[model samples]
Target: MRTYWDLCVGFARTGVTGYGGGPSTIPLIEYEAVKKYKWMTEEEFGESLALANTLPGPIATKMAAYVGYKIKGPLGAFVAIMAHIVPSLIGMLGLLGVLYTFKSSAVVKGMINGVAPVVGVMLAVMAYQFFQKGRQGLGSKWMIGMSLFSLCVIEFLNLHPGFVIILFLTSAFVWSTYKESGKTLFTRKQVMRSREEEL
Candidate 1:
């Protein structure tokens, strides 16, 4: 009911307002999911975004479907996908002729150029937020090290982004497990020392 409507409206806004494509729409989607409806926290959205990037196909569509499904299940997913793409589909159909007619017009070119910086700023802001969150959780040193390593691997070595994500995700999982085990062992040792003292 209300959940479904929210899904439709949120995704619709993203689909219609996003000018540049999948990447550009991410900030809009993040706002809707994190700030507007509170479907997920910023950290959850960041993780989901990373997971979505590792998959094939359109990122916005995938995000829309996932959020919808998370909120209201399969039916919500269908509604969300339709809501996200149908407006863009209709707009493209309606504007195809106009775009073709003004294909060489300077105004159209300028409009596109102007939008590029806005989209870039949106991406940069989201990235900075994610970096700040990471620093808080992992500390600045570990966060900086991982960021530099990832940048070098992807930019200099030309490694695939999906592989890098998988690598880091695995490392994080292993690190967490190791930390948990260490805590458990430390607790057990303390318990044993207490019993020995009592004896």
Candidate 2:
């Protein structure tokens, strides 16, 4: 019960503070679940993120459910998901009322304009963090090349991200399989020789 309450509170706070909707909430959710709570390892969190990205529903809610399930099973999942959603539900309702009332207010317009730049900066920071973390083994050259290639493919070619992901994964799978087969065929002789020597 205590665990459920704590999880609920944690996710509720995440929902309340998370700005700019689901995509924007990702970093905050990662921070709370992976860094603050130690509910999941970084690798586990990454896997959950990838899975959530592939699914249709709200990313933050999916993440919250996964982490909660990891901690306390189905009941925890219920608590965490409800916690994460409730704040957004309430806030959106209130925001809708305000927006309806102040639809033409200059102050609201100014506030929106002010927030846009801040949101841009936040997204930029998040992008930089993702790039730094993702480019660890590849080095800057490969990282930059991949980034440029992706941008060209997505922006210029107007390729769907799902297709790009499929193409990359298919290529990687073929290459990995080929490499493994070659290694297997060549390494058996060496292994046999080592075994004979041991005998």
**Number of clashing pairs per prediction, in order:** 0, 0
lDDT against the true structure, each candidate: 0.92, 0.82
For candidate 1, write residues 1-199 as lDDT tens digits. 9888898899999999988889889999999999999999988898888889878899999999888888888999999999999999999999999999998999999998998999999999988998998899889999999999999999999999888988987888999999999999999999999999999
Residue lDDT tens for model 2, 142-165: 778877888899999999876776
Best by TM-score: 1
Model 2: lDDT equals: 0.82
Give TM-scores for every candidate, taking all chains together and pairing residue i with residue i: 0.88, 0.83
> Pick by lDDT: which candidate is best?
1
The global Cα lDDT (0 to 1) of model 1 is 0.92
In candidate 1, which residue pairs clash? none
User: Every model's Cα RMSD, please?
Assistant: 2.0, 2.6
